[model samples]
Target: MPTLKQKPKQRPFCFSVKGHVKILRLVLTVTSMTFFIIAQAPEPYIVITGFEVTIIFFFIVLYTVRLDRLVNCVFWPLLDVINSMVAAVFMILISMLALIPETTTYIVIGGVFGLAASVFCIADGALIYRKLLFNPSGPYQKTAVHDRF
Candidate 1:
């Protein structure tokens, strides 16, 4: 009698490096935002507002980037590069501010999250660059068009 073979178990959620980084950024952003809001540090409303905006943007981009068809758009890679660069810079600055010696515990926690987010953003940017620009066969490469006109 032939025995039936068992199939490999499937993971409920599997993600690539880019996807993982994106998810990391999303979680860190939310954590930092919540901490900042709750900490109620005086002044510097811009930082709070920036976090709010970033949280919203990441939520949307996270969903869009997961769709392969959407990611194939000519502007998608460029947008990802720009977004990650900006986010990294912004997080670095915010983290520094959050790390002030006299800051509260919540601020310090937020700072740590911000730093993590910055690292993830930088990694995401580098990966996007590698995937879309560094490789010869990347999406941004121009192909010769032979027109019969």
Candidate 2:
């Protein structure tokens, strides 16, 4: 009789599939916040909100990336996807608003950063979507266990 072998489980701290996206997200978030702070814009609330959200999520992703097992939970991926989508939309809107006719150099720089962040967020969202929704054997897939009689 032939014996069936099960595939080995992935390590908990193994590199995440979304590693690149997460790093880019962190960089873009920090850059956007720094530029927004330095810019002398009339309204800083949008950037402030974006910065706060980005900081919070950045830490969450950082922690989860190190502990990949946490990502197996349904809530984490859903939250990440939704957050990325919202952040992208908000950044786009803010960037467009920041591009007024009389914008200063700093404001223009900040707007550019915001736009870049928006693009990153959108890419992250798409990657998350692929990981969660599109991939059949992804983290969310269920495996059946069999017992010999």
Candidate 3:
């Protein structure tokens, strides 16, 4: 019989069938626990679900990006998707309100506000994505590359 000091061995980073499942379960349990804790927070702001931090982060990022170079890259295209979604939402709500004559003024107000926000969102997302993904082409290139985007 094997001595009490002897134990079965396992390869590093190579989980057995049972071990792999256990790791997955552990990861999922931790993730769900974190999500529930965040969900329980009071006075949640930023109407967009699950992206509140993203909005604040982008706002800060846009304050720093150089707008000229960004237009040449992929930021503008992806922003189009975001803007279209915003516009479509505004249009649907406005159309529904148009059926009620009293809401015509509110519809106009909402449309204008929506249009402005859509533009801001596009510009902000593009600028932030570019800033986080690229570095200034100067002495800081190598060092910045090592840091987070």
- lDDT agreement with native, every candidate: 0.70, 0.66, 0.37
Tens-digit lDDT string for candidate 1 (44-132): 52365365456546544654545534555556666777878887887888788878764789878878888888888899788777766
Model 1 CA deviation exceeding 4 Å by range: 1-14, 42-74, 134-149
Q: Which candidate leads the pack in TM-score?
A: 2
TM-score of 3: 0.28
In candidate 3, how many Å is residue 4 off?
62
Candidates 1 and 2, the one with greater lDDT: 1
Model 3: per-residue lDDT, tens digit, 24-128?
323332332233234442122112212422433342244235342465655542453464345335434433333344334433343343334444444444433
Model 2 alpha-carbon drift over 4 Å, by segment: 1-17, 43-74, 137-149
Worst 10 residues of 1 by lDDT: 10-19
Error of 2 at 39 (Å): 1.8
Off by over 4 Å in 3: 1-102, 136-149
The predicted structure with the larger TM-score, 2 or 3, is 2
- Rank candidates, lDDT, best first: 1, 2, 3
